[model samples]
Every structure is written in structure tokens, then in C-alpha cells.
Target: MYGFEIEGGFTFYKFRDFDGSLSLSDDHLKWFWEKMGKAGQISVVFYDGSVESFEDFKKLAKLKDQHFFLGFKDGRPAGMFWLNGFTQRSCFVHLTIIPDFHGKAALQMGRGVLRHLLSVTDVSGSYILDCVKGLIPVMNSLACRMAQRSGFEKAGVIQKAVYLAAEDKSVDAAIFCAVRNNEVKVSE
Candidate 1:
């Protein structure tokens, strides 16, 4: 409700407070695809090992139950995320702090943005969500650690859950969760 929604954005979910938003015009979409296809970025997020074309990236971006947002700080892009499998109360999240901001303020931003997300309310004046989940590749220890620092708890692991394109194989995924009144503990 605080952020200005533009022509190419998810108006309901935009947040200016934490400086994260989704504005998906064609040109901006192209920028997202190009940035996400970077060697470091692609390895963690894409199962195809690459986004071969803008079309492919577009399809993924517009996939059912998936919403993407770019994080910003001082008007500069800082990170990005995919919110997947969104239901009335739960969703799966994949987040990445840009390489430049890595190890700098990952924990602070992650916790703040996530807590704010949990506090978002729908037009009906009800809390929109109660939980957010992270399904991370087991090999990505850094991500796992960051999730913990962001107040997520290790829930479990799913076998052969994530297919890494670069690895050309399926890898186990570690599940992490932050519940609104529990782990996340959002307050007024």
C-alpha cells in the first residue's frame, strides 16, 4: 500500500519502505533476464543453467503463483527474489542479494523485508500471510546460513528436489521456514 504501483508492476505487493518492488515492462524485463543470467545468479536460480532468451525468462517471470521483486537501497538495485507457490497463507521464496551487496547487509535487509512482507494486509484488512518458506539447494551453505540469520528455521530436506542446470543433476533441497507469529514475530 505504501509503494506507487506503475504500469508494469504488482500493485498489491509493491513496497517502497524496504525499497523492493516489481515493475515489469518489456525493457525492464530484459534487464532482469540479463542480470539473472549472470554466471553466479544463474547457477542458483535457474534449472536450465541459463535463460536462453528473453521469451524464456518472461515465461518464468509470469508463471503461475510466481512473483518477482527487485530490492533497492538509496534508489539503487540491491537484490532480487522469486515468490513461488503462493497460497493464501504460505509461499516459497528464493532470494539473492546482489553480488556487490553480498556479505555487506544481507541479514538486515532480508529480515526487514521479510518481516514487512508478513505484515502486509489485503484490502479486506486482514493479514495476507502467515508463513514464508525457502527451498534451497543443500550445497548452497551460504544461503542456508543466511536464511537462519534472517530468522528462518530448518524444517527438513526434500530428496532430489532441485535440478541444477549447471550440475545437470537433481540435488536435495533444504527447507526453511519463518512463521508470522513464531519465527518472524512481526509486531505492530
Candidate 2:
């Protein structure tokens, strides 16, 4: 039961019962978008502003500085995790789990993906997560809490940094970051 205690003393366990795996190539794009669509039901308002049509998602997926991964549970598509701003020293981490697996399972998937990203990948320095300040109860707020629990510290706020399509405008964003070094004890 590989796990870590996050804020609120909640323990997120890594799912071992299923054949969980992560695909880093574009081969899983179709399956990845399918899960993204389902996860968007909860995540759209917080981050994406609106659900991306399959065609639109395809285009976004091809954008520069973005890397996508599809996580499988029992050999089935279960979640999506991606890194943005990868060309720079710091990158953005984003994740979503399908609606069916929202609680412990989702956290488990997130932990697994994050663990892989921080440990096995060369993309290191600091990882940033920006959340819209207004979408508190919906997205950014929860993410802020989670970031702290996961050992990320509040960096600062970037005014009008994010554009919410739903509002068709820009909004303030709070940034959180996790820096990796030999001294940082990142849970495995």
C-alpha cells in the first residue's frame, strides 16, 4: 500500500489491484480525450472553462510545450495527466480522473502519475499549478489545498493570468509550486 498523508490527514493509496499503467506516447490520444471529456464534467468550470469538442481537444493536445499521459486501471482508460510549459525550467501539472473513480481512486491515480513525473522523468526544477481565484469552491481553491498537502508552497498570484472561456474574460490566478531537490522528501 504505497501512499502518502496529505493535508487533513487524508491518506491517498496507490491502486495495486488493477493493472495500472501510464502511456506517455500519442498512441493513446483518443482514449485520453474520452476520459478527459468525462472528467471535464467536474473539471471544466475550474480549468478549461468549457468542454472541448473532440476536434478541439485534438488540436489542443497537439499544442507545443504540452505532454500528455493516459493512465489505465485494469487495462482500461481511467485518467489523464499532463505537463505544460515543459520547455522551460518549471512546468505545469494537470490531472483529471474519470467521474466513475472520483475519490480514493482518483487520488491514487494522481499520486501515481505525480510520483512518476517527479521521480522517473527528467522534467524537474519546480512544478507549478495555476488556479483561477474566482473558481474557489469549484477548482483553484481545492487545488491550492491539495498543493500544500502535497508539499507545494504558495508562490504568488498572477493577476489576469488565466482566461476563462465560460466568462469570456481573464481572471486572477493563484500559483502553487513544488520544488524538487536532494533534500525534498517526495513520497514514493
Q: What lDDT tens digits, residue by residue, belong to model 1 across residues 135-179?
A: 888898888888888778889999998888876888998999888
Cα-based lDDT at residue 178, candidate 2: 56
lDDT score for candidate 2 against the true structure: 0.51
Poorly placed runs, candidate 2 (over 4 Å)? 1-27, 38-51, 121-139, 182-188
Best model per lDDT: 1
Instruction: Output the lDDT of residue 105, model 1.
Output: 60
| Top candidate by TM-score | 1
Clashes of each: 0, 0
